[model samples]
Target: MSVPKLLIFILLIFGSSTAFAQHEEEKFDAAGTILHHILDTHDWHITDIPTGTDAEGHATYTPIALHLPWFFYSSRDGFTFASGTESLLEKGYVPYHEGLYPLKAGVSVAEHMDDHGHLEIHMEEEAFKEAYVDEAVTVIDLSLTKTSLQMILIGLLLLFVFRGVAKAYQRREGQAPKGFQGAMEVVIIFIRDEVARPYLGDKAMVFLPYLLTLFFFIWFANLFGLMPFNSNIAGNISVTSALAVLTFIIIQVNGTKDYWRHIFNTPGVPWWLKFGIPIMPIVEVIGIFTKPFALAVRLFANITAGHFMVLGLVSLIFIMSNAGENVAGGLGIMPISVLFSLVIFALEMIVAIVQPFIFTLLTAVFVGMAMESHDDHH
Candidate 1:
């Protein structure tokens, strides 16, 4: 998943001078680069495949990714929807410091000191974060960012793929499974047997659909990022938080009266603890939220950190290479770096499926717990 991103981040780290040469040399900013990779961005950084060098010695980069639409809205700032970077700038939205800033008169432009530097252009999306700006506060950025784009793409993919799977069932009724349907049936049955039936019991069918959706949605998003040039969507906190929120909503909406009683008026506790100080009730209420919060943070942190590790290892190779000054030495270290990255990436592949199952399993567990009555418990 971090393949292309790791390479780009490596380029950014060991002096963008070697990587950019003529386009725009960037001073290595490790913090900015890591944060940029972990957090959701306006642009999806497809890999930069090198084209022929220009007459002026600038290396040409053919970026394979898409630039999603940029939307900015405010009562004073007015609304603007620009489909691309050029269009966004044309509308007077300055790309600066991880957000769209208002481009007003006398905006500070990037300067090059002949005594120390080469031509530096802040116009490109890559350099947007460090692009200097004096003014321009942010408005609502309802644009299709990396996360939103991935979500949309994955949603459509599920719709089409599962639609075909559904049709296969109709045409092949009572017949043996074939191809895609067969593969998915295996997963579907596993979820039904291991996840839904185990936790949900009698109401397994009622929640089976949601549990399947949760498992497939997450697993799909994770695997989607593994596709060449795709951005890491599941690693984003907002996306994980949304998944957690859905679990929370389902838990509360289906909670039995006993669930509320357990929280607000926890049983088996002393009167002093329950009514005198309101300690157990407060703790129980907080516990309800903590479950979902943990779900969100755990998924976000794990995926992000895994990507970070891969990128960091790749970056280390370049740093050791001294930006390719020592080609032999760099090549020597390449095998080790690649080996370690592959090992972790393989682990991440397993984690992609495991994490989703964990989330769905926990969600089912929570829901089942909430549905229990005094009679069932006793």
Candidate 2:
């Protein structure tokens, strides 16, 4: 079939599934539905299905979700564990939104909230301690969330693919590359020659492994996020932050004396700027941190915005449907929604490839700059 037809077919299948789930509720919460898909959670929600009806005759849905393990720690309970959120909830834990909280007897989670909608304690200091005297049983959530699980899957994929490719190389020592090996070789060479060598120069080989790993990991993670019924791994700020931190550490550790001097005692700048007020030094110091901060935010924002575009477009159909009241309106909007979602998905595919290259390139550039000598400036 044609590309347009294929997109329409896929969108129809996807949209209908989600719409059916949303229709189970009296009011379709577009924001909640969208957020639930985007955010990290303890459970992997595949889809929802109509199970039966409530006593009041309202529709009920049984979410086909994968319940992941929950790990929590608190001073009172020490290290505690549960099979999943359901088990914890059954054991006196309150399920509020995406998190679980332990409430004192007769004290509902809603009763403790302040005006701003956040959970806050307004009682006196002594009373506050008395209320939670069981040693702050608000367990610290260290569980492996959806994002972390997706990352682990990506790691396994990389390990398996590369291990196979490595065996192929051993078998065919000098033969002409073919099949998957050839495709993998093309990317590996591109990063080594085009990306790493230019910036890292003589040290390219030293950093080649790191650069290649960064590229493949980010690229794979991005592609995984685009898949249907998968978690948005790269879009999670925590993941990006960890990647950025790695780059930051490498750059700082490899920084030469000249790099440090350039920041604290800039050579070319006027003495007044360097020593009198120390403005330049402060700005330079801030730049050290801001570089990685920008890297993290850029990747996170681009990936997340791409998801929002696709999901938002798909959401239009259900929003226009008005809980199935305006069927004709929803049908009329389907074509437009599918077309836009297709375009965004295509653009996102390109972004998935390009963002990884950009990140690797910038990381190399930062490392190279840090290794620059005082003579290079002259």
Candidate 3:
């Protein structure tokens, strides 16, 4: 068979398996299911096995989840640590909505899923606090979540891969590159010559490490998100926000006097815009913030959207089948849906690589802009 034919066969098998696997749920909430997969959770969820039916006749599946250690601080209890949710619950904490809350008396942790498939937090913020503990009590979540653990693993993977590449360079000094090292050298040189040097100029070496780390971390995280049973690290806004903040800090710290002066009093611009209304200065200050904001949102949105597309397409099979109640309908749409999903999966792979490149290139441009001198511009 041709490669395209083989690819279609693989997608059909994968999609069919996924669709049947989801049949365990009596009722499928497509949005809720998608959100559950994309969002961070306290534990790593492997799969769900049908146990029995609930009182309402809805199917119940016991989730097979892998728990990470829980470490959080509560004003009422001071410091607390537990191996996982069960242990934490033993310590009077309940894992609710990806957070650990104190399980107070006369309180219930419940979730309401609407007909439209949106999950409504059963408790209001104040009510939630009242249920969990006293209003004055504060909880600080220091626990390792699914997303956090994935990020840490990605960091370790980068270390391992690059360490090998580093050794190859040292051992084969002055020799032509081969295999893995050659492939990595292509990327590293691409970033150094095409991204870092172009923007950072003579100071490329100074910022190369940070740029490389930023690029590889994001690219690895994105790729991992596409893998089976892996957390969407790049899709999480908090992760992207932290990365943006790092870039923001680097830009500000490296900002030359000329950079600030340009923001405050943009050269060659109307003095009226600078002094009379302070419009130029205001816009410049806002630009400083918007740069990082754009960086964070772009990566997070792009990555998240790709996952949503892939999940949504697969979900259509189950939804149309009505969780196996209408298997005929599902079979009818299966081919089209799976075909679209396969197309999207291919595109997402490209996006997984391109998004990081864009992010790193922009970072270099921003930093280089900060290091610009008045004399250089003139």
Candidate 4:
């Protein structure tokens, strides 16, 4: 056949196949849109494309997404491998009722019939909890999620950068810093002098490696999240909590005799207070976990909240403009959305720097507290 006819034939085959591939995606309500942007999922959602009607004559929109692998291993199943979420669904899961189990296939989760005659399960409810609580939890998700991907990227970026700097240092032995090395030297010196020294004292050098890594890693992760279509790494509580746990572990492991004594014994407190009250040591012990908890929550909240605000502002454009389908509305809303988003984006960048500093500084302070002598406290 001719080129034009062949092209037409190919289009007809594929175009008809995708007709019921999707439905007109539900409109993004403010809260849902904001949450969706902040929350982690199994795939990278790029955009949606319109398709023909479904059997029920509903307008369809096909999602264009990059899927991540799903890894689940159970004793019964040995190890199940699915290249993507769709594959997982085809393997066993059907519509995801609870705990990766198919609806009506096993555990019953509460469902309700909607006005449109559809069964809806509120996954946020007690039914989900009930379904999961007794279920044999055999699957371990080793899959790389969006957050996982971002973290790996951040780690590789840090590795590539500092490795180059390390080599630069070796090459330049006694010479002056140059290029990226010089720029990084300034930041490194700033961290060592400003953040680590004041708090960690002479032990600043001892803790500098971790403190420097924490600061730069966090800062990098925050900035990475700010990029368009990137996962919100800093905003993920799991990621932040893991970072805080590292600091906690390091602080505890490296804690001086003075630190343990300060926790258990009364240095300056009265005997009665130590024995009878027991509040001081209890408070001190609790403070250890609480400080790290605060670090995690603060970073997570600040980054997540900023992202939510930015997403909200951007979503406002779509809400008003409807992707230029409404020209008058688009013109009216575009400038407002852009202006506010830019302002928040700027603030978020500052926050990106400030939060990492705060985490590192507080970590230094906690370490110093643990290392400080009784004489030092006074």
Off by over 4 Å in 1: 1-34, 85-92, 103-138, 376-378
Cα lDDT computed for each candidate against the true fold: 0.75, 0.80, 0.84, 0.75
Q: Give the Å error, residue 249, model 1.
A: 0.8
Tens digits of lDDT, candidate 1, 236-268: 888889999999998999899889999987777
Cα RMSD to the true fold for all candidates: 6.1, 7.9, 7.6, 12.1
Q: Residue 65 in candidate 2 has what lDDT?
A: 79
TM-score of each: 0.81, 0.82, 0.83, 0.78
Tell me the tens digit of each residue's lDDT in model 2 across 164-187. Answer: 998999999999888999999999
Task: Return the top candidate by TM-score.
Answer: 3
Q: Best lDDT goes to which candidate?
A: 3
| lDDT of prediction 4 | 0.75
| TM-score between model 1 and native | 0.81
Tens digits of lDDT, candidate 3, 1-378: 235434543554455457546764465666657777899887898898999988889887877878788888988788888886557656776765676677775554334444433334556567666656545557798888899999999999999999999999999999999899999999999999999998899999999999999999999999999998999998999999999999999999999999999899899998999999899999999999999999998898888878877887888898789888999989998999989989999998999999999999999999999997779564
By TM-score, the candidates rank as 3, 2, 1, 4
Against the true structure, candidate 3 has what lDDT? 0.84
Q: Which stretches of candidate 4 lie over 4 Å from their true place?
A: 1-27, 49-64, 73-81, 86-140, 321-327, 375-378
How many angstroms is residue 141 displaced in model 2 relative to the true structure, after the best TM-score fit?
2.0
- How do the residues 291-326 of candidate 4 rate in per-residue lDDT, one tens digit apiece? 899989888878877776677677667656654567
